[model samples]
Target: MRRPPQELWETDVLTFRKMRNLLPKYVFKSLENTIKQRTKLDVSLAPIIATAMKDWAISKGASFYAHIFYPLTNITAEKHDGFLSVESDGSAITEFTGKALVQGEPDASSFANGGIRSTFEARGYTAWDVTSPAYVLETDNGVTLYIPTVFISWTGEALDKKMPLLRSNAAMSKAATRLLKLLGHSEVATVNSSCGAEQEYFLVDEHLAQMRPDILQTGRTLFGRPAAKGQQFDDHYFGAIPERVQILTQDIEERMYRLGILLKTRHNEVAPGQFEIAPFHEEANVASDHQQMIMTILKSTAKKHGFMCLLHEKPFSGINGSGKHVNWSVSNATQGNLLDPGDNPHQNLQFLLFCGAVIRGVHKYGRLLRAVVATAGNDHRLGANEAPPAIISVYLGKQLEDVFNQIKQGEVTSSAPAGVMSWDVPTLPEFPKDPGDRNRTSPFAFTGNRFEFRAVGSNQSVSGPLVALNTILTDSLTWVADKLEADLAKGIELDTAVYAVLRQIMDLHGNVIFGGDGYSEEWQTIAVKERGLLNLTTTADALPILKEQDIQELFETTGVLTASELKSRFHAYAEQYIEVIKMEADLVISMAKTMISPAASRHLSEVSATIMNLKQIGIELEQENAERVASLTNQMMDTVKNLGNALNEHNFTTIEEHMQYCAKTLRPMMDQVRKYADDIEGEVAHDLWPLPKYQEMLFIK
Candidate 1:
């Protein structure tokens, strides 16, 4: 039986409405101030709020609570504790104090702290993030109260994604508020960045997933030949959802709704067995937290429905990959969305200024944007035909580009209106169309009201990219505000001063805007040589941008991260890249040797036996198939040996050099080995093949 919308939606979440109803009016106001205004938390109200939260959670059938935090590994971490407190008289009573709710001590030795704290010094703190609401996570066995928190070291260094995100948001808000004031909005509200990440993923039957060692160990397949009828036919995009998958989606959406996540769209993505779910925009911090839970629920619910959710950017070869397109924007209660270009964009000075700020930010800190989304899994998706290219360029549609161009040329001109679309048929009514079409190939595209960052990988936490975007925008907005104030101080009129600043910005940073195909080879060449933009083709090329002095200064100047904290992130991400490649290299060797090579050898032996048997019967058989298998097996083993040797050659002097070796040297060697192994897969008998084929896994469901 299905439940009503009002009955099911947000029933498990302790949202602001729930809190307002549960707590006293005064306590609720104080907490709301803390959440909305970023003010200091009133300690006096914590006890009352804690008591209310406990009672509410208890009513929801929660016996335990967990302080959930996101560590550097781009995943959620939680340490659960019971509400039962033992007394000296052997009696147990449920007790949750304000202090316990506000603070938690979780051993951080095992988390990826990026050398922030030594293993011996295991002290870390989880401070409650009042901005993101707490909710009850229901599992098969029981339900637990999950409160999102920020993890930090004892020395006050930021050790988790949420801390930097919150700090970056603060920095952006301060700058945005200043800019809004400069635009003559004296009563500006607190500005915040918002995000709606469109998550793309694949699903394979759990039974088949368990049969493949590569899929079991890594989220992606190490080697598999392309399916004969893969997504090449272009039939799967927005195709009919399979019945089993539909049930899974319904279950996942119901769970998401209860957790207060507003999932807006679901459809078949370009690739077979691939799908995407997009949520409505929310505060960036809460959106990131919800994204992690969405991934968790997708996997858990898929498993219950006999499927394995694959979140890897490229889980299979020769098919479209997955990306988490982060649709980002900035807004406030006072002015509404800052990026919205209303009907007449020529007169929308506020929108133009804000849009110019983003342009300046992307132009100045494009490499930093690239570096944040760089990961081993994403390396396969970026620069491919299905995903955006490695170059970080903005795509403003024809209408907005025209307005910006007019501003650049030192004039105010008429803006293009959205035209109507109609067919000749009388029955087909006409509708208004957008001024310009969408460009899916663009890495950062301005779509309707927000910019969609299309390069983010499916498996990554949205915090890293959000932090980078907020920090860079903060820097850019601060620059814009300073310029405006300076021009105004010189007795320039407001409109003239704004146009002067925008003209200067366009002249300097306009090359980052492109409304063309980013995946084309011509654009790749022109973007670098003609436009002077970077084409960071690999993670090794991209991650080095994080360590640049300008990037370090950007973080330092904005108060988003200290010098040590930024350096630690560079180290941690570089180490992760190296480790991922190393792990994949090891898997390639193991699977090729233990699974692929043995199967090929057995088939070769059988073929040779058949040849001998036919010869005895005076009917000769050609050994072309057997010879091809034998040759491919030898080539694969030899390449695997070379890959092993390269992996063992860890005599590099710097982490940068090690990363380059992994990218330039070892990755190609692994691909070389895979080529041979995949060729063998084609030649081997289907019944004797050790691993599941791509055809079955992709099309079975």
Candidate 2:
């Protein structure tokens, strides 16, 4: 039966709602009540809720439950246990207790902790994070209880992502409240960090994705020729979403929305099969939890729709990569957005003060800000033409920058020029457009009311970057608040004191502000030599800065992260970088030796045979074809040997040594290997290639 296009889209949306509706109604209702209460979990209600959760899971045919937590690895961990026990009557029974609901113990020795945990001391605890609700994973046989929790070691050392994120939120809120109070907004309470993360990803057909060993193993195509019809035409950006992709997106969005995630936008991106989904802003902690859920659901939903979601920064070569653009801002229960510039921001003293605080934060801690987004996968994306450069800078637009300049020059009555808008009717009122234009190339850009951090990697847990952002902003805001309090106590007028601080901040750290192109070579030179900004280019270069005296003092004073916890995170990130590189190198060597090299050799043999037969029969074959095949075959052979040697020589004695090896030897060799393989792919016949080509995988329905 042929279905109408609109009906087809509606069907996809409906399918998603159905999947979400499969969950018990009471579960969602409980979440709603929980959100409304906005308090610590009631001890009395714990058991009742646990019983309800157990019963719901049992009804869904669940036999086991897992306390799922995000560890230092930045990925989720789960420890599953069946719900079976013997009753007094010698009958089988399933049971779950409040204690089990509240906490679980998992081994911690293997997890990275910067020497916090010894091999003999393997115990780790998972304490339920009541802020994030539980969900059920229905498998073919039975369901699994997925409890969101925070992991910690026996000695109370934080060993998970959630703890730091929660602490950072608290830090930001506390500091923000202090600043708000100074601005005479005493009614405002419970300041919160809000984030709207735009998740970008690529969708390839599951069958073709699985056929490529590199994609299957590395979450990207390690080597593939560029597709003839890439995103060069720019037709794919915000273009009509493909029907199959639309179905998958609809299904995912409905599921997410039902789970209380406010998904706001979905559209095609610049790369083929690359799409972005953005959610409405929410409290930073809730937003981070939802971001993780969105990624998991996107992957699962894509599978159902016969697609594979590639969240890697560079899923394909010669095309735009994916990124998680983290839009961040602060707000309060009463005052709304702290970052918002109302109709006339020039008169809005509070908004200008907070903006100055952000500018100071980004300038003072730009190195740490760069460190937040550093990752092995992201290393390939950053500084490329498609993404933000390595240098950290803020884009405040022309209006705001000029306003700050005017203030710094001691000018009074600084105001934006009134803009005009025409209405069709003569009696109708006219409106003005926004005062500033957007700079997509900027790493930290102030859009309407929030700063969009464009450098965050797609697969990263937004928690890490948001944590850094909130902590740094809190530190800067505290400084601003202290200065303002001292000035007011010294009998300086409030407006004069505010203006003094804003002017001082702008004059000192104003160099970080740039409204021009961030991707240009000229900007890079200006950012470093001209502005004297730190350009920490890689994870290795940036990770060590976390331990610097200034950063340590900032984290300690703000109480966002303890020194021990920060060190643990440093080790975790450094180790993760080396591990990712090793994995990629191993995959490259395996594919080159087992798949690409052999295929190239076979093609070479066939071409040589054809050439020999043509010569024997006195028939002149195309010399260009034979020469092309020979050149590619020789290049592939040399690259494979070099890649094998590089992989074999990698010293994995220590994490630091391994990371050094990867940076100096393994990565460069792998790139070389991929270069030759990609070249060969362009020359080799499609039938002779062992894996699916880029054109087929990118364009196939």
Task: Judge candidate 2 against the unseen true structure and give its global Cα lDDT, from 0 to 1.
Answer: 0.82
TM-score of each candidate? 0.99, 0.91
Using alpha carbons, what is the TM-score of model 2? 0.91
For 413-530, candidate 1 gives per-residue lDDT tens digits of 7999899999989999999999878999999999998999999999999999999999999999999999999999999999999999999999999999999888788998899999
Best by TM-score: 1
- Quality of model 1 by C-alpha lDDT: 0.93
What is the C-alpha RMSD, rounded to one decimal, of candidate 1?
0.9
Which tens-of-lDDT digit does each residue in 474-496 have in candidate 2? 98899899999999999999999
Q: State the weakest 10-residue window (summed lDDT) of model 1.
A: 1-10
Top model by lDDT, which number? 1
Predictions: Cα RMSD each: 0.9, 4.6
